[model samples]
Target: MAPRSAVLLATRNVLYVSIAGDLIVAAIKVGAAAYTGGSAMWSEAVHSLVDSSNSILLLYGVHRAKRTPDQEHPFGYGREIYFWSFVVAVQVFALGAGVALVEGVTHVLHPTPIAFAEVNYIVLGLSALFDGATWLIALRGFRRGAGDSDLFQAMRASKDPPSFMVVFEDSAALIGLVIALVGSYLSIRLDLPILDGVASILISLVLALTAVFLARETKGLLIGESADPAIVMSLLRIAREMEGVAHANGILTVHLAPRQIAVALSLEFSDELQTPALEIKVSELEQRLRALHPEVIAVFVKPQTALGYAEAVERRRGKTRQIVFHTPSPPGPA
Candidate 1:
């Protein structure tokens, strides 16, 4: 197993913070739901409960991902985090969103009146306080590698699931709270009990949408999304600048874990370089690449001339790539 480090454990502190706040909030919400019989409050309690459980799963995923590479899985357990994250997404949709919707529909059909509206108001206030603080903590590093990209773009580009998953959940929670507040207030003030159920339904929709978003993001990682474009570009520059290299064809990278990446480089080295000398150069090259990006756990070097590399890339373009991706256009002349 790779030694544990802060890098390997990205967003761990965030998960810890999330679990603590969610546990406290879940308890408070559960109590309030029992006291008030508000459908929205019950939904909120369930949401908090699911959030707490998801945080535990994420933490466990992070732990399991740190296990050493073995004969069964040579790339280490890094991508196990992706698998668990996907499971979290499934849980959100199945448990969190599904339960909220079920509760909403049940109350909508039954139209149960919420008692002691003040209790819900007080609980909402406290829930917001707790969720808001933790949301802010999760948001702190959201833009770390996003550069000048907008929020949605940054999220799409993010390679680390946990780095932003909590944000989605917390943001949905806060929105659902607002909706619940509105639903409850109108239901009580207007003596329309169904509005509270409507609010719960709305919260359910929010969670459902959040789950879809999370699942989509996580699916990409689980299947293998590339490292950040900037990371790939930087490593390509490093390869091109290395001694004895004539051209750096390109590099391929996949995130084995949030902080773990596997890289392969195709480079055209000087023809004068003999096999033994080329071996030393490749070793030094790997050292330089690792020094720059410790996340790059494995580097496979492929030697080929520029023209040969281009031809090889072109020949395999339609044959193999089409199996994975469908390009809009065939290759054009250089």
Candidate 2:
């Protein structure tokens, strides 16, 4: 696996490129929309502007998240990235989707003939080239981070929001660009300007869906999600194999940041070890874990018997099943 610093540098580079591209694209799109009076082009301008702003916010979040740990907030501001990412999702929905929807609806109600058709075509083609380039950059970074996993699985398994957020936004922009191209063509060819408005609405729907997906993903990260199951299992195995540990009942791991993990292990040490010896064993375990996994920033060892841990796990499982079973069936027949 590539070093975390290398991954972060790559992510920052992609975001910088995206911001520059979006600024250029937005300016061209707005100019085209003004000259052509095309609703779809106007919506595209809004999309680019929103994406640019999101890129800026994400950069700011990365800066804030890197602040050193302090007394007030011991875990650092690592989740700041997730918070800003969630904000980006909201903006995409409210400004990008909501504005496009409203503008499209108005245009449909009172259709406007498009002028300067060639200008829109030229601008959109250029925008597609720029957006495509940025999309590829983001895609390459994501693929490197994803390693062996497929795209969908990589997305689901990814902990880094900045890396994935750009990919999602750029993908949406590319699709919206295609939609605008089609809508403009149909409006001019069919002599039905309302198709331009319809195209705007379709673009808005795309933005809305992207926003929703981004929100859901970012929310999980913001609320505290576990590290990978493979990592957790490995930690457990290491603990069990140690000379002083009788059992490794359970392991809990959470991502404090994309590159930082906090691990808490439930361990039952050998009966022969006294308090001082137990402390020594705990120190040794922590050192070994850190040496093996540099991302693990904190290690918390909780002494618990095998029976107690088993009971706790069973109780949690039972509660989970109860919740699932009692989840109100969707308005069943009375």
Candidate 3:
């Protein structure tokens, strides 16, 4: 809806880069943990595994939301993006946070010895490097697309998938890497291997917080939130400007999706209007309304009063025309 070409391409690039990097890093972390016998490395590996899953889920949402509108869903599947994003959040909470918390608790209860401190550091460094590139690209996309809008509004209105998911996941991954490094270094230096598990707990907490935020937003969309307050005000103003419109009978706007809306309104007209002219007035109102609010995909206008005014005007015009026709014929004959 908004200029989507740049945003779409950026989204795709961000997805691929993040997915590849996360998956690779996850594998390396898991393997390094197994080889070095470091609980911290294991916790990070699990965190990355969940990150990879969340990225995949976001990609799925991006693709599904792009599907064309069908008979059962004439409004299009744009909202499906939010649905899939919700699933991603759930995965972050369930898979990432849940696993990390469990591992952290286990380490706190029963400590393990650290053997792969050097390897864990190397793996963490590599993960950070890869995350940096993905984050920069995603940030650039957000800057170009988000502009003055708030992040939630941008995500809500964005037709492009990458701008939302890629940016979020990449940012999370970068932060997670830093946290993992700190936990690992602390565990190795203090000879308190259980601290590695504590790192996992912290990662879990971060994921949970992110998931909760996303859940609240996505749930609002699923239940249907109102459009921007400004847009609603704009529509009301435009309706009041109509020539025959007494006032906007009422204005109702529903957010069908991030970029689409359905509007239904009642219109009260003057007491002395005519049918033919009323048709012209209706057409004018529709055109002006569309121009004022592009998100208004559909508008239904109902006349709030009886057609008495329009019918009276028609009757008056008919009588006037009849008298003129008769008068003109008599003059010619004379």
Candidate 4:
């Protein structure tokens, strides 16, 4: 199978596992919350439900993103994944964090003794076990995608949001479960039922932070992020080494999808090379680039003098700087 297809299948499998685990956990949490009237348990139930929904949305995004290139969208529908992932982040903030915060605050205002606190503890323990399993699955996928990078670094470097997003969501869920267990225990032992509400608030905070981080990460991709620096360097090196290439001015690379990159190169051919020779050289360079980096889907080579290319780049940079300087800043608080 193709690499892109492989990646999509792997993502779908992981999401399927997550969805199943979340459905089970949510059901258990809801029953426990109904029976024991624990605010934290209720919050957990909601969290699980939201997670399940997110998995479905991510799967849908993956599906939509895989659509073949069309006349309307010549670049294909790759950015659809970024768009839907951003939506997932917003949903996490709205449905997951927003609901949890409101529920927590309501419980804090009207503190109520938790019935059968032991039941909540039991459910939380089981839920933790289940969530941990799903978390491990996500972590393994993320680690494979990351190669040798650490978790935080992997998250930042990952172009595929679903890979890391699931990891973050599951990690938060596990932490929330631990907090709920502690809060339930403390509430029972100390007769401080309000601690349950505080626990829910803490869980909401975790979800909110995760949502914000996901949003920040996905925003760049949605707005057309560049390809990896290493990939860009490799492309330039390949072009420069070509026989008829006088100078490789610069390379511009952008990710059309996680595994799809579009490359544009400005090359100054040797004066000694004829038009036919330059055409052949360009084709050779394109093939070499694709061979070196299979992710490069499209390549455009433009014939230009090195001096002209440099001047154009400088003008572009100056305009960007001017725009940045002239942009209005938000007003500071009084």
Candidate 5:
């Protein structure tokens, strides 16, 4: 099977495992919360519930994103990942973090007793272990699929593989579990019930921060940011190596989808190849490009007249000069 297909399948499998883990964790936490009557456990339970929901949303997005390209959306539904990911963050903040904060603040004002501390602690510890293992699975999938890029960037450019959501959700769940344990211990041992509330507030803060970060990052991709600079440079190198391309006049690379890019380049031929030779060279170049960058979804080569080539060179020079003048520089020798 193709690498892309393999990656997609691998992602799906990881997500499936993650979803199972999430459901189990959520069920355990909810049961513990109901039985223990501990505010910290309840807060953790809320976090797990949202995380489980987010996993379901991610699975849906992944499946939707795999739909074949259509007339209205020729690029397919890859960007749907961004929308769904953003929604996940919003949901986490609204349902989990917001509720926790309100309850925490209220409890701080008027604290309450907690019962069945031992059971809550055992449940939290088990949840933490499960979350940790799930996170490792996600991390492994990420390392296998993302190549040399940053983890977040790899995830952003790629489809909404369930493993990506699994990673974030599990990591968050682990933290929430730790906070709940601390708070529960304090409530039961020290008779400081407010620590339970404080713990909840701290978990909320973590969730809010997580939501804002996810929103900020995904929003940029949803709005159509450029592909990675390294990827662009690789494309440029491929163009420069083409037999007929005398000079790389200009290249425009845009992300049509995560890990899929469209390239439009103005290239100059060396004294212009003969018709047959140009055709052969172009075919060869296209083949080479596909081999070099699997991420390039489409490439359009624009032949330039000599005069047009000169104009393009001059434009690039002008742009370079402007960039040099406008860009800030650190202090240096005169």
Candidate 6:
């Protein structure tokens, strides 16, 4: 199978597992909340339901992002994943956090005694088991790409949403479960039902923070974060090694999708090379680049003199810090 197809399959599988687990957990949580009249349990139910919906949206985003490039969108619809990811963040903040917060406040004001706190304990424990399993699945997928980095670093470096998003959701769910368990235990032990509502508020806070963080990361991608700096440097190195190439000026890149990148390279070719030779050199360079990095979907090459390349850089001066090779002096008399 193709690399992109494999990526889609893996992502879809993760989403499917999460959606199934959350639906089953949510159903049980709702029943427990209704039976026990526990605010935290109710909040957890909402959280699980929201998680299932978010995973579905992510699955859809993955599919939409797979659309083939056309005239209107020459780079394809890869950024669709980022856009939908942002929308998921909004839903978490608005629907998930908002509902939990409101429920928490109402419960605190009413201060009703929780019934059968033991039921909440059972439900939370089971939910944790389910959520923990799914979390491990997502983490394993993320770790495949993360190398030696920690989970937090991996999330920030990850270009794909479903990979890290599920991690974030399941992490919050697990933490929220612990808070519910503690709150349920304390509320019954201390005869303070308001503690249950406070626990719900904490869960809401966790969800809110997760949403904010997810939004910031997805926003960077939506605004077109460049591919890894390493990838950029490697592409320049490849172009510099070409036989007809005099100087590899620099490379420009943007991630069209997690695995899809569009690259533009500037090169100074040897003066004696005619049009036919230059075309062959360009084709050879592109083939080499794609062979080494299959993720680079398109490469745009520009033929420029050293002076022209310098002038182009000068025009864009101060826009952002740039890493570029010093222009080489013209070749000595042959």
TM-score of each: 0.91, 0.93, 0.79, 0.93, 0.84, 0.93
| lDDT (Cα, tens digit) per residue for candidate 6, span 199-305 | 99999999999999999999999999888988998999999999999998888899989999999998989999999998999999999999999999999999988
Name the candidate that leads on TM-score.
4
- Number of the predicted model whose lDDT against the real structure is largest: 2
> Per-residue CA lDDT of candidate 5, range 1-334, in tens?
9887887788777777777887888899889878876777777878877887887887787777777789998777777866787788888889888988987887788888777777887898889887888899888988776778898777666543354657766777788888888888888799999998899898888788877766766677667767677777887898898766888877777665556777877777878578788777777777787798887777788877655766667777784322323667788988
lDDT (0 to 1) per candidate: 0.89, 0.92, 0.73, 0.90, 0.77, 0.91
- lDDT string, candidate 3, 1-334, tens digits: 4644445556667777778878888888889988877665676787778777777777777677678888999888877777877787788788878887888889888978677578888888887887787778777767786788787677656543436656666667777777778888888889887788888788788878877866776777767777777788888788788888886656677776556778766678776778887778878877887887766777777677434434444576784222223444445554
Cand. 1 TM to true fold: 0.91
The pairs that clash in candidate 2 are: none
lDDT computed for candidate 4: 0.90
Provide backbone clash counts, one per model.
1, 0, 3, 0, 1, 0
Query: Candidate 1, overall lDDT?
Result: 0.89
Ranking by lDDT: 2, 6, 4, 1, 5, 3
Residue 50's lDDT within candidate 2 is: 99
Task: Look at candidate 4 and tell me the lDDT of residue 31.
Answer: 98
Worst lDDT 10-window in candidate 4: 318-327
Encode model 2's per-residue lDDT on 1-334: one tens digit a residue: 5686777778889999999999999999998998899999999999999999999999999889989999997988888999999999999999999999998999999999889899989999999999999999999989987988788778878999989989999999999999999999999999999999999999999999999999999999989999998888888888999998988999889998898899999899988999999999999999889888888989999889987787777887884322323666599688
Candidate 3 regions with alpha-carbon error over 4 angstroms? 1-6, 149-162, 272-283, 305-334
